[model samples]
Target: MAVVRSLRQYVEPVVFGAQMACSFFDTGLQMVVKQRSENATSPSDPHEDQNAIANFYMIFNMLTDFIPILPALILARIGDRGYRKVPIVVPLVGYSLSRALLLLVIWLEWRIEVMYVAPVIYGLCGGFSSYWAGVIALVSVSTSEEQRSLRIMRIELVYGIAGFLGSLASGHLFQLYTVGMKQGVLLASMSVALYVFCLLYATCVLQVSRITLERRESTSSGIITHNRQDRTIIALLFISGILYDVAVAGGVQILSVYVLNAPLEWSASEVGYGNAAGFLIFITSFLGMKFFTRFAVSDTSMIMIGMVSFMTGIYFMTFVTTTAMYFLARSVMLFALIPMPTIRSLLSKQVQGTSYGMTFICLQVSFTLASVATAPIYTKIYESTLDTYPGFVFTLSSIITFLSILPISVVGCRAAKQENYERIQGN
Candidate 1:
């Protein structure tokens, strides 16, 4: 309780959560990705491989995240019991060991010799390091039911703000380093250091933390009591995660390059900075929930409502040629979902104990599949002459993303209406 109280008071969700979003390809993300992907066959051209490897890195990270997301629910279900820690703790060690090796590989610059070493290392490091979902699950133990919905909001909100700031920070860092410090391989060395820092910090936190959940008596108490009742919230999480990734990949990653390449060739760092500025507007999620609580009316509704805003935002983005227009498009991506808070809250109501960790983990899996599916989905949808129709890819994504929202929207609307009627009757 003391530790929980301390964390709640000292660590605002946004600040602590920002750690994941703070760095990017420019500051060190690219180097990390490259070092991670070094083992792959040399691309015919180095330039094209940059984007491709980065995309592939997402696949690796998704795999690592998949193992932990559900474990989060279980860990929370187990609470402070030593067993809760087992599922998460054992994996944490395995993950850390792999990450440490990745850092060592980068430090050695083994890619220069084997080339493919980076890719193999990337996969190994990526498939292993997955403390994020479990971290979320542990945090869940500290929060009350009322806070769970808001916690979901914080995850999205903080990522938006932190991602933006990191982009901005990376831009400045890149400019400073490239002009004054170092470039290319030297830059890769710096990223290796950063990874070490992240790994070290994670280890220290895990080691020092005295926090533990109060143990429930029996294993049955922690097991999911929901009886697999078909719930609207569960379905919505799965669907929303998929669409969210498509939106992120298409709107943020792919479109940034598209916009930048339109007239001027923005360097990687510049692109990173621009992306941060756009995501900063997602701070609106905080405002949406805090002031206009109606915006995030429900978790189930977030996917539906966010989808409409997101798809429209993407359509609006396709026509955008300027950096400012790109920002506008990304901002829409930030605030499209008003129903997320409500929906997450609904989830808290449904899931109890370690099950919360499992549910959240499942959502992570959804995001993973969605992120990995991007290239395949894009390739399958388009004609071979996709080069001629830059807009075709964006357009296809919009249509599919929009279509994906229908089922969730229906379930969410029904829930919202039922809740409204119940309120009226109480009055």
Candidate 2:
């Protein structure tokens, strides 16, 4: 807002437009992706299919994010004067139209075949945001390798706390006031309307920085090293973040279904409370870095440990037959949030300035993949569970959750050994 006031009139409008464009497109593509995923027949190898679809979203979302800059960033380096604006604007507009169309589906009540559209709409929105863009870019351009996750933790800390609060509020509202889909839709609509105002203000009010061609070429050239280690770490993060995505998208849809039917016998409101409880754990993680860092476990060790703990939490859900037990299990899982920031900071530290965008992109990619992978897996598992004891649905989720940790263990060990080797080399 301040930036706009100092520059030109209606700068806020551009900012707003940029924002609107992102919201519009992000929602749009997500809807289409999910619509397709949901309609596809449940595969025999549900896990494999889930993993594939999830990974596609993960990669596509990230590519839509950082990869969009290749032409502008790289071209600017090569003295392609006119190409600079192309990178920033083209995707923004593309994302916007996509979102608008996606929302239209929901508003129009698209047929049953388009059922998965909502989650995809939500996913695309995340892929095209200032929060996602600026923070990642900042870390890539300015931060060191070791500190990326720490900063990411800070970001996630804010994210966790805010998310936790929102979850609690939403849960409480649903539980307390009996808010359902109709109210939820009204609330969302109001939010979109407010967003319209924000878009106009930022675009019209914000000042733009004029860049010289020579400086643009020089900076873009020196911005990122394009190193192999950086790329490898990214690949690992991309894979790991999927764990989170699957837990999120699948958890919301499938867990709700499972919990509503299980021995826990939680009502809709209680289910909301359960989710809020998990977010509470996420929020507590903000304090984890302060107290837990002294274990002197490096970030990689912590990530490995966190993943194990996270999987353990999911595994415990399988055994839980009562709401009391569910509460107890989630409480213990609070410790797992610590690793989130630790990993995020690791990536942030590795890359500086705009390059953190690359790291951000990696994390987002993992997130998208998780969502895609879980879609079919959830449908298949749910179907199978119907044939067995319905309670076993939760149990199956636990197995998959814990099984996912094996990869993290391998990655963590690799990272830990890498740090030790670097230390030995330094000596």
Best candidate according to lDDT:
1
Q: All candidates' TM-scores?
A: 0.70, 0.61
Candidate 1 whole-model C-alpha lDDT, 0 to 1:
0.51
Q: 282 in model 1: Cα distance from truth in Å? A: 3.6
Give the Cα lDDT of each candidate. 0.51, 0.47
* Maximum-TM-score candidate: 1
**Per-residue lDDT over 377-425 for candidate 1, one digit per residue giving the tens place of the 0 to 100 score:** 5533332323455556666667766766776777667667767876999
Error of 2 at 381 (Å): 1.1
Q: Provide the lDDT at 316 for model 1.
A: 75
lDDT of model 2 at residue 368? 47
Candidate 2 residue spans exceeding 4 A from truth: 1-135, 139-147, 171-186, 193-237, 243-252, 262-268, 339-341, 348-355, 391-427
